[model samples]
Every structure is written in structure tokens, then in C-alpha cells.
Target: MTTLICTLQDHRDDVNWCAFSGNLLATCSGDKTLRVYSTSDFSELAFSPLSGHGYSVHCCCFSACGQFLASCSTDATVVIWSMVSGEIEAVLEHPGRSPVRICALSPDSVHLVSGASDGTLALWDFPSKQLCRTGTVNEATLVACSFSPCSQVFVTGSTYGDLRLWDLEMRQLHAEKNAHDLGVTCCTFAPSILSGGQVVQFRLASCGQDSQLKIWAINKFNFGGYKMHLLHTLTGQSAPVLSCAYSSDGQLLVSGSVDKTVTVYDANNALLLYTLNQHERYVTACCFSPTAPIIATGSMDKTVNIWRLEDGCRGRDGKSVPEQSALTSSEGRKKIYLPIHLCIS
Candidate 1:
């Protein structure tokens, strides 16, 4: 394997979110720019300066089909862009002291949900361009909001260290938990495909200011009735974990932290990988390629690094040795010599 690094040199300010869709990468930055890059060569594909946001773009994501892009910002608005034409399709505004921190589109792409600093969650109908419903959860500023992979449920975490689940159909609280000891910075639900046979399990991974990554499994159906079991708690970094994602295969999880490193762990909570000690700044975001063994990380150091997992050792019989066993034997030491280079652009 060969490793190639491509420095995205366009943003004048810090990048908040980097999203991948097909062969395209969409980066939202504080520079007021939304850049699209070709994944094949990391070449600039399109550059569009979005002006509606009064301040920094906080978060962005692509639609499931890659047809649309949604972004939230300190400007107190969320904008949906049409990927086909690179045009702004909708601009959602919230008045008063609320600044949208996170925005997510439903699986159907017909609705949108946003969490704001005002501690209110709003559900909007895309075509109608009207607020369909609103839920209040005191005055705890929301840090992140995500729709479950199945699209029937949504979860939001706030500064009060609470995670609340909402049911779209009834617009009611489906489940709630104090998921973290400190302000919850991020939360992600496991994919439905990982639970076998389409029966989606309500397992979620969350991280917070407490510097702990906790996995909570929700096993029941009634509102506030699900059992919360601690699957694992990862601790090591000196700083808080800001972002996390599970590999498509559900066997690995990657997390980025303000500690300036990215750590990859197996499903059993063993530390399987780590990288990025060269940069002396915070690692803001990280994600696994939807179809590759590559992991991409964005950092406050103003660079993105793409890393590939290398096969450690091959037995003389041409079979691969387990990573653990490879680390324990002399032959394994001889077989594992170098880190494979990954080709990035």
C-alpha cells in the first residue's frame, strides 16, 4: 500500500465538517466557503461561497442519495443545497438567541431536524418549508443531533449531559438518558444493517467533555422504557472526543479528539489502531470511508490525513496471522516490517 496526502488549500478559515458522497467531498469551513473535491485525486471539483450564514459554518452533511447537502452555522440558519446545480434550495431560519449547531435530513429526504443553542429541536417539512413541530427540553444547549439509521427515531445530546430520543410519528419523547457525566459533544446510532436481518437495534455511541466514549444499548420499545447497558467506556485521551464513526462493517470505530490523535477500536473495545502524532494541534473530526479501509481525519492543524489499515503479517502458508498473535512471536516480528502506504490525493 502507498499513502498519499493531499492538502486542501482553499479555506481561509477552519473547516468544521467534511462529508463524503460517492467520489465527492464537501467541506464546510468558517471561511464562508463550501468546497467540493474529487475523492479520486483530491482535486478541487467546485467552489461555492455560501453567504447566508452570518458566521461560521458549524456542521454539514450529505443526503443519503448524495443529491443534496445540508449545513448549519452560527448564522442561526440551515441551508440545503442542490448537488446537481450547486444551488441553495432552501434556507431555514431561527429567530432570537438560537444558533443552529447541528442539522440532519431524514432518510426520506422530505424532512429536516435541527438542534440549536436555545435547547429547542425543530422538525421541518422540506417541501412545505414550514416548521412541522417543535420540542422543548429546558435550556440545555444541544451539541449534536442525529437520526437513527432506520429513520424512525432521532436522538439529541445537550450541554446538560442528557441524550433524548424522539419518535417522528408521534412527535413525542421515545427514550431519554443521562448519557454522559459532562456535556455530550457527539452521539451516533449504530447502523440498521449491522443488527442482522434488518431488525435495527438502538445502540448508540456517545462522547462528551468528560473525555469518555460510552456505548449505550437501548433494548426496549416504550418511551423511556429501554434498558441502558454500558457496552464499553474508552478512556485515554487527555482531551475530549469531538467526533466518532463506526466502520461500515460494524467491526471498528474511529474517534477524533482535541488531544490531536485519532484512535481506532474494535467492536470488543480493544485499541486496534492510532495515528497522527506529528500534528501539534487538536484533531477535530474523523470518518471511515463508506467502502474502503481508509480513514480520513481533519485537524485544527489545518490538514487532513488519510490512513490505510495495513495487513501486519502473512504466514509462510500465505494465510494472515492475527494481529495479537503477530505481536507475540519472532516470526510475526519478522513478517511485520513496515506500515503499508495508502494512496490518497
Candidate 2:
């Protein structure tokens, strides 16, 4: 079971995206700035708004190592900030006026990729902080991009509903397809690890305006080159799906939609688990924390909500959250899914 933990309220305008590194949280906003906070609700590790973007910051993500934060904005710029120093380490501007919809960092945090509404994609060498390559999709906008957990391949989703996979090392398109009937809003890759620390098939989840979420499986063990196969189409969202994320263990999948609800599903079984309908407005963005038992969501209502897992709700393996009773139940003498809200720091 999941319960709302904190209402991260600070953005003057709509919150566009939220991400977490360890217990630290980061949010991008339409107010043209980004803010970071501590999950523990303690002032010992909190800070005020960090404003430098010339336009709305569309998305932000912490690097794999959590040592750096990368954000993209409508100002055609991507800023890389050092987590240790709280200072701008580098600024990368896209070639044109088109807003960079989102950006992703390689698993090793050695490279960065940004996508724009004009269907342009640019790859940057983080060591030198320079743009090294570029590509374009057939659609009107590239809505999302994500690097595989293996750090070898990357995927891009387009506004016009196109999906493409690319080889990072070879700098070539690995696979391309028209993924959805409508615009693809978000995409996320499953973690590389499986049971017993064994590496197996690769999987991806993507949400779109079609009001459907699709899970794609990539079988690298194939004798031929790896190919994408649609594994499941998870439905129930009545409105356009805006954002989605797979839990760190790849057992649970969560998605936010224009329907003003957040849905969670059993990733392996594709069973609908829970729907969090707490947001009054469209839920724009969401992500799972790397080192915490919580997930954070951002919305057009200018607030971020952190949903935390109960102590006994998750499986001992830490991969799955067991199905709970529809009404209510007790887990180890504690009321499971006890609704609560907190404003900290």
C-alpha cells in the first residue's frame, strides 16, 4: 500500500517534473526555475528556489550516481548542475527556439540527451559538456527520451506517436516504430537486474494520448539483433496519459494522466493495483526515488505529492508490492494505506 507523505509546495506556477536522488527531491516548474528538498522534512538539507532558466523548465533528472542534476527548459537550454556545489556546472542550448521536452542521462552519467518539440534530438558529451551528435524524428516533437539501464541504448518518444531506439556507442538507430495512435508523452525503461541479480530481457513502458500504456519487451538474447515486441497494453486511464515510471526494482509501474489520477500496476502481471486520484488537476509528471521507499508526483496544480510505501506492504524481495484488500486491511497491526498529508520544510 502507498500513502501520501509530503506535499511539496513552492512552485508559483505549474510543476512540470519531479525526480529523486537518495532522499533528496528535485522539481522543475513553469515558473522557470528548479528546486531541491530533503525527503526527511528536515531543514538540514533544504534550499530555496534556484532560478536561472530563461523559460519554463520542462524536466529534470538526477544522474545515476546522484552527483549531478540535469534539466531542460523551454528556453532551448539544458543546464547541468553539480549536486555537491549547488552551482551550475554547464549550460547547453539547443540550436533553435523549440522547447526541449525532456532530457536523460546515461547510466554512467557520462553523456546527456535532449529532445525537442521540433523532432530534434541532441547528444552531449558530459565530460567536455559539448554537443556531439544530432538526430531528427518524423514527428512534430520528441516528447521523451530515456537511456537503457545497460547504458548502451536509448529510446525516444515523439509527439506524433513515434518511438525509436538508438545505439549509444554506434550512434545509430537500432529500432523504430509508430508506437501509439496519438502523441507519446512519456517513456521509461525497466531496471537491468532481475531475480537473484541475474540480467535478462529488457523492457520499456510508454504512455500516450491514446489513453493507453504499453509495455515493450526487448529480447537481447535473440540470435538476431534485438527487436522490440509489445508485451502488454495496460488500460483503464480515461484521459491522456502524461507521464509514467517503473519502480527501481521493475516490479511496480505507475502512471499519471490528464484524468487527474495516478494508477499503479503489477509490472509483471499487468494487473491494475491502485489508482491515486488525489490531484485536482492533471498530473503532469512522476518518478520513483532511487534510494527511498517513495514516489513523487508533480501536477498542473503547482504542487508535488510524495507517496510512500508501508513497511510490510512490499515483498521481502523488494521487487513486488502485494495486492491488498479493496476496502481496508491491517499490516502488522498498522492500518495499511492510511491516508495522511504533511508539509515539511
| Highest lDDT model number | 2
Model 2 Cα lDDT, one tens digit per residue, 94-125: 86657888899987888889989888888888
Clashes of each: 5, 1
lDDT tens readout by residue for model 1, 1-345:
212233454566666777676666777777776777656655555545555567888788878788788888878888888878788888888645488888877666677888899888888886676878877767988887777777767888888888887877535454455677768888877664334342335667788888877777755443334345677888746688887776656666767788876666664454544434533367676666665566666666555555555531111221222333221112421212223233332
Top TM-score hit: 2
Off by over 4 Å in 2: 42-46, 169-176, 193-200, 221-224, 311-345
Would you estimate the TM-scores of all the predictions?
Answer: 0.82, 0.86
